[model samples]
Target: MPFTIGESVLFFGIISLTTIVIRFLPFILFPENKKTPGYIAYLGRVLPYTIIGMLVIYCLKDISFTASPFGLPELISAAVIIVLHLWKNHTFLSIGAGTIMYMLLVQFIF
Candidate 1:
């Protein structure tokens, strides 16, 4: 079966509208406030570490121990970032340095 342009536009519009609504509806419904719930506050505190762990795990998921290089630079960069974060408690600087280090390592060494 052949699809028409009008049908395609309608489908795309509906999808775009649905996506926008789903993405922003929660914010519109429940606006942010200074006083958040206890559980939410706890979750907010833990979520960054959880997200970082997930991201690190995801980056290392396909690494093979026997493979040459084997994403060692990424592992080292992550460790460096962790250390810097622990020592200085600067999120943006740690991430920026880690990313730059990783890119340089990849470009020069690997």
Candidate 2:
């Protein structure tokens, strides 16, 4: 499907306006000089940990106890990520190494 110049302009104008509004909405609603609400502040403080926990659970949501390799690849990868994170406290290294290890394990080992 193709849009005419007018239609394209109108569509893009609405998209740009929406993007700008969403990007600035936080700043507009929560000014730097004003105190943020307790719930919002608490969410900012605690959401990262909860999000990480959710992601870890999501990653391990699939497992077959009776299958070949028996979830070893994922378990090993998780352990590697944990060790790397504790060893260096580096986010990129831990995730990168763990991802590479998991890719190799699934492709070659299992």
List the global CA lDDT of all models.
0.85, 0.92
At residue 49, candidate 2 shows an lDDT of 85
Candidate 2's TM-score: 0.55
Q: Give candidates' CA RMSD values in order.
A: 5.0, 4.7
Model 1, 39-100: lDDT tens digits are 77788689988898898688779877689788788788989898999999998999999999
Which lDDT value does model 1 have at 96?
98
* lDDT accuracy of residue 7 in candidate 2: 97
lDDT of 2 by residue, 41-91 (tens): 898799998998899789788887688788899999999999999999999
Candidate 1 lDDT trough over 10 residues, lowest sum = 26-35
| After superposition, candidate 1 runs with Cα above 4 Å error | 1-52
Q: Among these predicted structures, which one has the highest TM-score?
A: 2
Checking candidate 1 for backbone clashes, the offending pairs are none
Error of 1 at 102 (Å): 0.4
Q: Residue 40 of candidate 1: its Cα lDDT? A: 70
